[model samples]
Target chain A: MAGQPPKVDVPILKDLTIDNITENVHRINSQGSDPRLKYILERLVTHLHDFARETRLSTDEWMAGIEFLTAVGKKCTDVRQEFILLSDTLGLSLLVDSIDHPKPPSSTEGTVLGPYHTHDAHDLDLGSAISGDPSGTPLLCLCTVKATSGAPIADAKVDIWETDSKGSYDVQYSDYSGEPDGRAVIKSDKEGVFWFKAIVPVPYSIPFDGPVGKMLKVLGRHSWRPSHMHFMFEKGGFDRLITTLFLRGDPYETSDAVFGVKDSLVIELGTVSAEQAKKYGVEEGTKLLTHDFVLVTDEETRKLRDEEALKAMRKLGREGMTIINGQLVPDVD
Target chain B: MAGQPPKVDVPILKDLTIDNITENVHRINSQGSDPRLKYILERLVTHLHDFARETRLSTDEWMAGIEFLTAVGKKCTDVRQEFILLSDTLGLSLLVDSIDHPKPPSSTEGTVLGPYHTHDAHDLDLGSAISGDPSGTPLLCLCTVKATSGAPIADAKVDIWETDSKGSYDVQYSDYSGEPDGRAVIKSDKEGVFWFKAIVPVPYSIPFDGPVGKMLKVLGRHSWRPSHMHFMFEKGGFDRLITTLFLRGDPYETSDAVFGVKDSLVIELGTVSAEQAKKYGVEEGTKLLTHDFVLVTDEETRKLRDEEALKAMRKLGREGMTIINGQLVPDVD
Candidate 1:
């Protein structure tokens, strides 16, 4: 009795029925100070309650969902994130990524930032080897960064990471001594070009011993991602791009478990001649992977995203809903 | 390449657009062997994706949701279930309870079984005291159990638990030495009567130090349940009942944080005369509370539930969906 009760001025919620429960929940949550949070909570409750009502969800099923979520949370560690994996397998990660990072037709598209990225990648110079002790096929990566206006963008920071010959990241090993291997961070030169020496990435299964993996199995889905190299580009005055380059010949190219592959992001590995390989200071018959990334300026990206949002709003013209300052709100008028 | 790929014959998911992502996900998940699981998952994915798409959920917002769920999951332990608390505060618990345990009009309505109930309650005699300490107001309880068909249901197992005067269950204490206090498991006598002495149940806050508590605060809501005693009844040939009895005058009776209160479950406590208190072997001026529970037979409950399910299915008459063996499935015709 001494503690303060809820400060919300709404009438006390009582005798809730299935038909009115969603509205009552929205009323209670409307008291939040942040309009965006309130809006998101309202939509979340609507969809969640609708799901329950439509399915006639049983008590046992609800308990199973709770237990499954608990297991996923328990499976997450400093190095592993099962929740993100859940989002990825459910195709939500890609959907969010696509919505938040709309780009022009000429600009490079973005994808999901998988859970394996770390901040401790060794900073290496251009043309340096990313693999510490390579056992895979030698690969020579040649990349160029440019703006959509055909202007070379120099000094762009590029972070690269990938799995090794045995289809395992450095962090996935038991004896991982906190050293960065098969990954590096480098910047483009004045000519807007950066090349790195690395082994060809190998197709690998996600950590399939966890709850997300169990869910994929139950869904009759695989956990294998296509052989790919992760890349993140950061520069001032431009929208950041987080993407992956999938090898064209990989068996999982079309069935990437994370739904991260895009048509433009897939490229075939060309077999370089012995002379060309030697000229690049690599083995006699190295595989060459080449790509040119076109970035859109931040200002242009904002405009494009606003257009997309407006289109979506028009498509979802539900009664009583309106967009104000790009946020969905109840139309008071 | 040595491991078997997904056995399901669905085509590889490719170029998933906002308009087609839902269909692709469903197509992939349709390969699941269990029809029930497949149906549940299809609905879950549909609602989940719709929630995101309708909100145009940003990447940052998605990450925040993932983190929030992770925190909620990590907050659970052997004795505490934060997910259930989340479900309760969201009103899903009561919805599922109402759907799965439909009963006749005369039968007592069931509510949520709050997270505090424990199976370790001491099995006391029919009229023994359930409290361990003498710190709170003494009260006497008399209860009767009968079938809706007007027959007494003797020897029914009655599990009762409540918070003490300090608004804390015995298990909430750090020094809980595996002893039962303010809780008991008793059987009704031959006349379907049970009575016990206990301290007046106190209004209490749910565990608010976890993610669920933080969520409530953000929503401008309190976490208090009304002063109530939890009761679970089980008898042969009858449907099990999990419900709580609220004191009528409690301020939070109508605004129970978990939405567990119902009109039929509220009762008023009466002051007993000095002679009456002495007759019950209690101190003078003790409070007396009484209730008679009407339970439905298992067969009758099944019939009611089937009717409810049929009504719900009719209400959700979605095209291309049909009920087969009481399960929702896609109609081929």
Candidate 2:
């Protein structure tokens, strides 16, 4: 089309106001084979244009933003996803997660995936100590996994990770190099029960060495996340439930920086006397906590998750070729 | 703050909804060290959050966007500014330019300062053909510069650039090494007149070897810009005028891909007979055209332009540092 005669749009330079930018995006036949991408990109363009006009963003401001994003990309490595932290602090990640994973009243609620979970969570037997470091006050924890209908979800896989008493996950410490710590994978026994003795969770700040930290400083916001334990549950024929558990009454719970904590995800931390701790074969005056998880992964859940996956595919341009003027076409330079 | 006890936010996870994100951005002590920057960032965060919610943007979709931006950054260099191209194609650069350079009724209009514009536009004298390479149809051109109030703008600096007959800028051709071809800078005579013999511009495509090209393909939009000549005029103590002039009646005059053609910037190209061409000391049956530019830089125009610049500064966080809970504070990690 470079050398072809161009379709002239007669100049009418009168009164082309800023609002036209928002409208022009929709008029460009940007819609492609996937109606969903059309919807998403259209929304994005509208929002972005509105943002520019409302603030009257200048060229310098825009260039500064571009530079900030470039730095964020450069900071990303195998162990760090600064973009995810960016989305988390902005509350976008949790918002999308919530939209994609709504559950029945009894099911465990999902929350923010606060940048610490890894793929290597390995299984251990029930009643085992999740952390062998023995560096903090112990917690005897027990949990159950069940289906929405109250049936025991046998062999459901659960991954758990939490901060140490010092409020730092092992990976966040100097020696770990982002290695998994205070984390373990365990399967529910025949009775659908999982138990472990580990340290009590504490509030912690997110990584502050990158662009997200700079943004937070500019916004006058803190980077603290409320004390909580991460949990992910999955079993065949059931929708995977990724969530976190917070100790009720934790002070920072209201402002979990990334806003990951939910009321339904809260459970009590019970204190046990030295004698009772001895009976459980644990440290004296230990804390005891127990909770059950309910999952929903039947037909309706499957369809919903499938829709989320499809939206992702459309975004990646994996689902269809870009259509031009309602006609199938390959990319033309 | 990593090991310090977090500021207690008294736990109450209820009322944290998608709508809260929009409201929360505004609630920030958006008053920064630069009040304007605070306002713009607040608006940006609000619009962006709302867009995410409206789209229910999934993690994969967000990541795909990040990857797209990263590629755009990596594609940019000293020779290539994909970011500017992004702004131009999206119609933003023109929109902002229009707002900042609005003129009175008699003043020449301004348009996009396309990515091809370089700092290297050098000086040439009147009657000199811009392209000594002698590859295009000759054009004997004449132009004048004036003040909005009818006074001649003596000694005004005029910089002009255009595509050759084949509709390609020198920079787009590898052999040129971005040297000037159909482009020149010249000083207006005492009568505010400028003259030259050069090739007539034809419609052209922007560089298509980058991510922007891929975006154009996916959006089903052409990459062509209408045939035009770029003009930048500046005189001592007057506002600079940066714009493009498109030939009237050209086919792409109406459907300019970049939406740069303005009726006020459009003029005629007249044909000259072989004898007349000979009399003008040029090739037989050549073409002739003339245009006059009027600049606006009086008190009224200065005030308006100043206001526009201020608005942009405000958008760049010009008013204050970010205030937190109504108090000025440094960034906290």
Candidate 3:
């Protein structure tokens, strides 16, 4: 080969395209990448690559994907996280929550970790309700508790919050009533039951002012979550569950913007007789949802006792830490 | 339990600070938030958690970290990727390069895959040098290719590129003069040698204008890479090699800003004797560097040929294709 012409070095840029998703997956997987970041990246890369291949994605389209995600990150703030919403919309929220907390055989199944479970709910009277506005249909929320095996459990703590009569959570308004005031923690009474009064929830769209909303527009999809109430119940000896219950008949129930609603979670408000409704002080046609939550009893939990007042609670063998504008008291049962 | 005090329902929020690095590592090795994302996320989480613990990081500090990363993503542009630079500074670039193109026994070792290797390099004539400036030092580069058995292998293609006297790649400055023109392909002569004249290499820093620069400032680090020339070589019936040759005494020899410098890749550029300089038609004091590159030759590659190119050469098939700007060409090769 001494006198032969120099070998041709033909460019193969096409090989770098996403036409071969499996090969690209193998390339990333077989390559020496960060072991810790590998699985997530591999799955992400594979899914993304497969998506590109599926769509016959062009360079500009891939670039747009990057741009959309960047905008989502930019849209996140102290109270709002568009990236989280993007995750919620992509069903990643439910997937991540399911992976973190597997279902217990008898306890209510946990659902998507909604974006608003930021602060600890305050303990309230047995009949207190979070929504205070008077613009929507009235609803009586009956809360009951039982062991997985049907044994009654009294004094179970129930923290509940829902949208107002106008279908707006307290946090959604420009003027918040109180940071944690709308939220409440109630104790079941002597009958292993607690009850609160609130307006029936109306389905509403998630805030569409951010990049996530922009993405929804680009994908030609709606950004509304079904009407729902956030619930964080922490009883003695059970895994703390963070979940939500959607209004069964909401329009978005089937396509719950966040993929959060489950069949087991849909509760029907059995109608009470007009005479019985008058006895409790509500109209007969008014919606009243009765839900008896069952807690799994086998799980062990460590509780922190709260004092009578915030100041007393602060001094209960704990050092109070200030974060931003809020005080974080360590929960010691 | 029924008569428990109202204050007793709260659970103690312990410090709950994860302090043990080993335990964190174990946790990552055990479970990630999502099984699908676990393997990769575990490692990433491990590294991130370890980094946080190692820094004795504060909550605000951690939040700042998140914010910083968010900013990086937001700052990325269509042509610029700040996250890649972040990864470069963190030694992730070399890690990726190492895993992607593991070196063969006889080929020169590869180095960092800079963010700018966007397209295949262009080929140039043997006597042509990419240097266009008239004032920089005039130095000659000579390459000798030999098989692992010490036999010369003629007709090999050598791709080359280096920063100009001002220390900037073309893409970085977009001034063309600072770019690598005719830097991609150089063919070996009958003696298994290729040579060209240009200015001696100089140490340079990566661009520090964007979020990457900001990150370097926050971390209190510099951004200098050792002087080096990037190279990629291939021939018929042999493995393609991508590598670099570092200037032995560059300022960042030990502390390469991106941690890309390797011992085996360093080469000395000895001063040429006046007589030898004259023989090469260069002024006195001109430098001459000689690098002997050995390639690995195996039977499997010997029989291999570019199907289209070979067909074109034999006048038996459709001619090969060419691309101008990310599109197929009908006439040019």
Candidate 4:
């Protein structure tokens, strides 16, 4: 560690003011070893430095900045994260999701990973709908899986959930559930089609209990996120897409708090005859949203399938565990 | 806005298992409009992705990650930022500081900005230290501000502060006078010689009331930052440097939770006699550390002489403001 300091090392003490933040970032970019890392940090530094300069940030202001971030962390619990909400509201999550989940033409578009995607969704029969309430306008949720072309691909796992007519998802209305509301895992039938019955999703607001809410108040922005239904479409040889379907013409659709809308993901809820609703076990006159998903498969998707298999094997204990005094140990012969 | 998606844009439901985070980063590097921004964000995205993969992260874990960041934001009030601490502990602050304040062959090296540097410290006469604690060993803090080749830098601003012997900083202890604590703002004498009396700083821990502490707990790491004195040196026209004089041999130096240390920045805190201390108007029989700082000057520093001018500009129209007509309006002549 005591080698001669490089000759290029020069003292820069007298000119390292806030204004030099940009130049300093540039110098680091040119001098640092990891180009990619340097790039990202450089941009971040510029933005941060610019923010400081713009605010003419006081030491107290800076300290408060730190304190604000600290609160974001403390507010997290087993079910929610305000920081993610921060990122989500900042549009980073949607931008990232868009960048990460590029789809084939005509395929269902992806959206935000809403806060209520719990691990314990109950699996239900193909025709079973989640809404038990006899009130509210009934709607048919129908979707078909297809390849990039028009060919149907059957037996895709389609997990679906949405807010009740009251605009409350099960996770949000934890008190109102005998069985959890708005959560159901189903598989497409042999004809590559899946249908369920549920009430139309109504627009809902983002959580207002945390820092995100505080930020919204500070920024004079509303706390509402657009109405949408969460979906997870998976097949053995296709990449899993965790997405959402937005109700077309919903006022919030165009200005989703998280910026999660795409034209491809918006679908219309069409009015159906009462006779048709009765045939589908719905009360005659009702509305239905007909939607279909087309998924493209590739080598990377095959790899994901393999990984999923490995995960299943691990979960099922196909790899035998050791028994010691009636206790199961993970690493015994 | 939807005049046909860009040719490169893939559908949202296409195969999204692409393993090209790196390649995409490189592509963005050369092809992006704002090369600097592209470089920065691309690298950040890569590192973030890598961090996620390295952790074998899960949805809940990712949720936790999001929550951690959110809590960081929430913890940010007027005086704290847990995320900065997170960055500090992860070596990002030092990395940024070093990148911004590269050391020259002869000038003193710069370091990270510590947590307690918010207020615009009050200026003091030569030899008058801010804090008056008697718990730690007393020291004669002295420095000669010279150029890279040893030319004197007279009338330079030499702001300084360090913890008392009992390891408490003025800001951290109770019953503080409204004045700043453990801090002194002084100008170098005509000979570029600056000297004062103060106790050696003791190693201390970061404020432990936030998410940073929780993160440390999860990582099984200690939260102690090393013993060091804060310094901000400026001259007319020169870039201001925020740095620290670290105590060598400090147990926490190598593992300073914030990692704000450097070899050139370490100064010897030696022993001196009571008579010598008295000669310096310091109490007799107190120990002392003698050190000299070498500063470099250029057009950038010569401008720092206008610190007063800078201060004046910040105190705009406030001088004329009054509660006129029962409302807080400016007083008119």
Each model's chain A TM-score: 0.94, 0.81, 0.69, 0.74
The residue pairs in collision within model 1 are none
lDDT of 2 at B141: 82
TM-score, second chain, candidate 1: 0.94
> What is the two-chain DockQ of model 3?
0.05
Best by DockQ: 1
- Candidate 3 ranges beyond 4 A from true positions: A1-63, A104-107, A177-182, A272-285, A297-333, B1-333
Prediction 1 TM-score vs. true:
0.95
> How many residue pairs clash per model?
0, 22, 19, 64
Write the residue-wise lDDT of candidate 4 on A45-116 in tens digits: 455554333223334444455566666667666566667777666544654454444565566666668666
Worst 10 residues of 3 chain B by lDDT: B8-17
Task: Please provide, for model 2 over A146-225, each residue's C-alpha lDDT reduced to its tens digit, 9 standing for 90 to 100.
Answer: 88888998898888988787777776666674445688888898888888877888877788878888877776666777
How well is each residue in B222-285 modelled by candidate 4, as lDDT tens digits?
6675678888888875556677887878766555556566667776676667667656776665
lDDT of 3 by residue, A202-309 (tens): 777776777766644543356666687777676677655666776767666655656677767877666756985876676787688887777654332111111122
**Which 10-residue window of candidate 2 chain B scores lowest in summed lDDT?**
B321-330
For all candidates, state DockQ relative to the true structure: 0.61, 0.23, 0.05, 0.13
Model 4, chain B: what is the TM-score? 0.75
Can you rank all candidates by TM-score, best first?
Answer: 1, 2, 4, 3
Q: Give the runs in model 4 whose Cα sits over 4 Å from its true position.
A: A1-82, A86-112, A116-138, A142-227, A231-243, A246-271, A279-285, A290-333, B1-39, B53-56, B173-178, B273-275, B297-333
TM-score (C-alpha) between model 2 and the true structure: 0.75
RMSD of each: 2.2, 8.0, 16.7, 13.2
Better of 1 and 4 by TM-score: 1
- Evaluated at residue A333, the lDDT of candidate 1 is 53
